[model samples]
Target chain A: MPKTAFQRVFPYLLVLPTFVFVALFTLYPVTRTVTDSLYKPARRAADPSVFVFLENYADLFDSTHYLGARFVQILGNTFAFTLATVVFSVPLAFLFALLLNRQLRGTGFLRFAIFYPALLPLIGAASIWAFFYSDTIGLFNTILRGFGLTGVNWLGDPNVVLYAIVLLNIWKQSSYCMIFYLAGLQNIPRDIYEAAQLDGAGWFYQLRYMTVPLLRRTTLFVVLITVTYSFQTVEQLQVLNQGNPADRGNLLLYFIFQSIGERRNWGYVNAMTVVLVLLLLAFTLTNFLLFERRDDDKA
Target chain B: MLQRSLRMLCLLLVASLLAVTPFVQAQAQVVVDFYYPTAVDGPITQTIQEYATKFEAMHPNIKINPVYTGSYTQTRDTIRTELAAQDVIVDVAVMLATDLTSFVEEETIVPAQQFIDRMENGEAFVANFFEAFLANCRDEEGTIWSVPFQRSTPILYYNADLFRAEGVEVPRNVNELIEVAQKLHTPERAGLLMPVAGGFPIWLYQSFAAGFGQPLIEADPAKVYFNSDASLAAVEFLTKLGMPTSEGGFGVGPMGGSVWGDTPTAFTSGQAAMIYHTTGSLTNILRNATFEVGVAFLPSGLPNENGEGYAAPTGGGNLYIFAATEPEVQEAAWLWVEFLASDEVQSDWGARTGYVAATRGAWEIDPLKTLVEEKPQYLVARNQLAHAYKEFDSYRSIDVQLIINNALSSIISGNVPLSQAKATLDAAQAQIDSLLAEYR
Candidate 1:
């Protein structure tokens, strides 16, 4: 089969504008961020933009102050938060999807209930959760007090604020993940389940073997999306705790925000942005490698 | 069919071109968009818009748009980014005093005093402003980069009911304040309150430093004197008052409120026995409180000392004209600023919002004078202006405040010892010094 030159060029031409736009808006800024990471903080407003190669990176490793330690602490917080969110959210989403896939009454309404939180704007959900986390006047603490238990400062305590944020993140994002799982469940062959049932398999066995094996791709997709989304989850941190209670809940992105927005140290902020991009890239690569090995083993 | 399709395409192209043409055209009127941070409360945005409307009405030639940017720090960043991108120039901004130093250093704003001097109302304008107000508005080189708009200094706000209930005298000095706070503090009830959030703690600390006869920062403005003996003593004193019982100080607790909205509520609700806040909170108190409120000078450093009985830092908002604005737009802005400073407007603005007028003539107005006389707190703010000092001039003042506030919070929350807190503050100061040196 011979392809015409025009036919091959037509597709590339059609996508050329989009490619250019992405290059200008996304790739250029990212490259500039990486370049800026090599420079030191500009000494004076009048000083020429001199490149201080690797100085900013060196400062990140210095132990005189807690900047380096703080960076690691925030990174750990982000990883812990994201891991906990995925662990809770992925399983719950699968459960909801499985329940919704069943031939039951009000399944349509149940699907709607499962997907409702996905429709909420992130900051609006964060705001509502912030009110619930409020110490003096909050529903959660009030319930705790009613049970004759001492109220915990949900967002104020350094020990618990990360978990509180993770709780909020899971609450907002699980419904979204459930939608994907539900769609995946619908795509699975009904004949497989029916054959499993006829083979003396119960619902649990069917779900454990046939359904779970068939949903591996979907599960991989969900994990990748949720992990990336977690890295970029700035709104909840911004609106709820604002990385407060002594910056204990600060994520990498939130630290970047504080550096650029609050401190106006764009150079250092750009350096932090470079670090974040590398971190996310590493996570993505690890996910791909792990999933690819699993696929190979199954084959 | 081809002719009909061509006609349809022509019509679509014309519609699209019409939609794009206005964006290409240079607007007829000089539209000056001003981004202003709300200095006090929320509704003040409406008041600022009203002022913008009046300015627009007076000068139909120039359209003035006032955007309610968030906090002062937010406004600074927004303006800086806008300028860096060479986007729509923020023709004017209401910047904080602490922010003006950085903006001036960055060459983001024009010197308003020179611009004012170049204007027709130059001499009259220079004559009208208060000396202290004018001094605080100037840059390091004495160039006035902003005009004082809404100004305030910290004043003592006491609960009259609590004073009567505890049978304690009002504190006129720091020693007396400590004594009275000790006597008045009741656990699970009311105690003394100082806001350690945002810029409030810096104001309190700077005021205390000034009262202790200590310089806040060095003359170069690149160094901090925070770790000095007097400053450390002041921090120790403040930490002692705010520290919880577990930390070996009076167990006074932190109170929550928007600077303008919550302090009055805390006092009137009897959740706080005494509040150290700006007199700007006076209007909220007058409007909302049913409790009898007593106003007094901020407690002085020590008795029989050269330090004044009360010292206040210049706390206020300043209006800055952008360097990139057109001359005509600057003229329109000058006219509006002058109008705002006029006796009638200043008095009205003072009467409406609890801000003290930037000019002395605002106090001379009979109605404004009577209002101040009726509410002595307004008079206290006005009288405190003489003792008021400008906040520290440094690019890192806000960051320093955040560190100090967090350190103070740790002390107050019983998470850290006062000695450890002081050491942490000194380390924080050292970090700031390094930042200053790096920037320098």
Candidate 2:
């Protein structure tokens, strides 16, 4: 059957504006990033433009630098940080959410206390943590000194700085991630827990067996989100560490920020950004597929 | 009846005149969309807005609309993005003096001298800033692209009471700094503190390098001496200060971890006997310090073999007038710049805000002189002006600084061998060279 003119134009009309918007906002930048990464910018205003493909990438992979202080080391630290935050924060969030779900005195106030860090801006939170980490007047060190012990330089020490940030992030992220878990826990029928209890299952047993399996969907969501954010988090580093002393907290995002934003090395930052997006995409896809398959098997 | 009609006609004429007057007045007013960004302090914006209001009242024909962009970098990005959109988003802006090269590249801002050349007292106004500050605003061709607004230099702030208690004088050179720091070091107190986080190590080290009679940037903008013997010696001096207690680095204290404002916090808490920071921090330090705060010149640089001491590096931002073809808007921007640069405004700003008034005339003003008289601490930064050099600013300013800063951090923290510091600096020089070569 021959289609009318209206039919022929209908699909294109429907798709074109959305495509244009996406292209303007997203695809255009993505393409520009890819192309821009091929050329080095003229450093001096008077210099003519020149293309230097793959040179920026080569700089990243420079092998002459120390293993502990190289670009690869920064990437490794980013991954280690992301994984550590997820592993530690997600379960803690779940546990808190479960406990808060019970009708208990002070639970209302308790939820606010847990969730307040999420309310503060990330940099503000970092600053607060910096106060606690201060050697002279900081609570952590002051308390230690009162006991006749030497104070620790939490953010100053290379070995302890990353963990100190991680601890602050956990304190912050668990509060935020708890909200999602609370909503997820609400969806779980109370009957399952009551039925398990009737069968004389302990609270720990119920939490381990039923709660864990039931919260799988929530756990996947929490993991996906927390993982994505942990890799990109730069505020704490910018505020406290700035990925100092061997790029301890220099995530891919910060590397991009310092390289491109501060230095005008857009080509190198674009190259790094491309790699970062690909890694994140891979991570998201793996999580999505693994979870979706698990659900399919159960069904 | 004829007289009554004449009176009605007169009233109608008056009403019509009033109706037309507003439209004419609106057309007469030139609106200057100004972008002013303060990265360090938030309150400075309120002060700027008040100044804008005052300017508006004085120049009824000119209206100043001030937009407070978030940070220095954010302001640059926003202006760049705005200009890229083919929009004149701002007619005048306060941006980092070091950003002159980039603005010139984009043609987003015009040379202040271009506009200043026509105004009364223009030449003197252009030259009013401290010599060290004016250098940052000049291009290689000697065009003055911006006029100084907020300017500062590093100064030494120590606990006067602590020094007295310790029975020691303030450190004047590397030897004294180390010796005094060792004497002052305790489990509870680090003798000295200077921030090393992010790009600060380079910022503060410029003072040391200058005092050693080594300039970081050559006369040629394209060439820099980051890995030079002098800079290495400066870095080594810096590393020694932050060395472990066993290694005699008591001077660095817990400064490796503290960045920016925290250095002041460390000092005010009595954990640090002396600190190296900007004079901009003086007011905040004074307000918080429980003990007597002493302001002094930065430890005289590691004296050269000839016993010459180089000056401290001047740092801060300037006001750049955005390029506009419209004569009225361009003229209005100059008015705003000149007003902001006036001794009255500069003095008021200097007194209220901690930033040093950039204009030499501002220092001569009676109120400002009285301020210097009342708190001699305010004079330390100004006194260092004679010894001050232009800050190490180039086209890719942050990039170069970060490279050097990271190297210092590695030397101090990685406990890397001295040879490795050279390697790190060589890598920086290579990167900086690559960045500048195409333009050169």
Top model by DockQ, which number? 2
Task: Give the winner by lDDT.
Answer: 2
Tens digits of lDDT, candidate 2, A153-239: 676666777898889889989988999999988999999889999999998899889888888888888999899899888888887
Clashing pairs in 1: none
Among all windows of ten consecutive residues in candidate 2 chain B, which has the lowest summed lDDT?
Answer: B302-311
RMSD of 1: 5.5
Q: What is the DockQ for all candidates, taken in turn? A: 0.19, 0.38
Taking the tens digit of each residue's C-alpha lDDT, what string does model 1 give over B1-440?
A: 99999999999999999998886574467777878776666477777778778877877666777788887768877876786576747887778866766667667677887777777867777767766577667766766778888777778888887688778888878888777876777643346776543224566778777677685764456667776777767766666664556756655544221122334566766667787887777888767767788888788876644436457777778888877787888877777667766777777778777887888888889668888878767887777777666666676655655555555444433345555866766776776776667556
After superposition, the stretches of candidate 2 with alpha carbons farther than 4 Å from their true spots are A1-24, A42-59, A63-70, A103-105, A193-205, A262-264, B1-27, B39-42, B105-107, B119-122, B165-167, B248-252, B255-257, B303-307, B324-327, B415-419
Candidate 2 per-residue lDDT, tens place, B225-256, comes to 88788788788777666667575545447635
- Give the per-residue Cα lDDT of candidate 1 at A90: 92
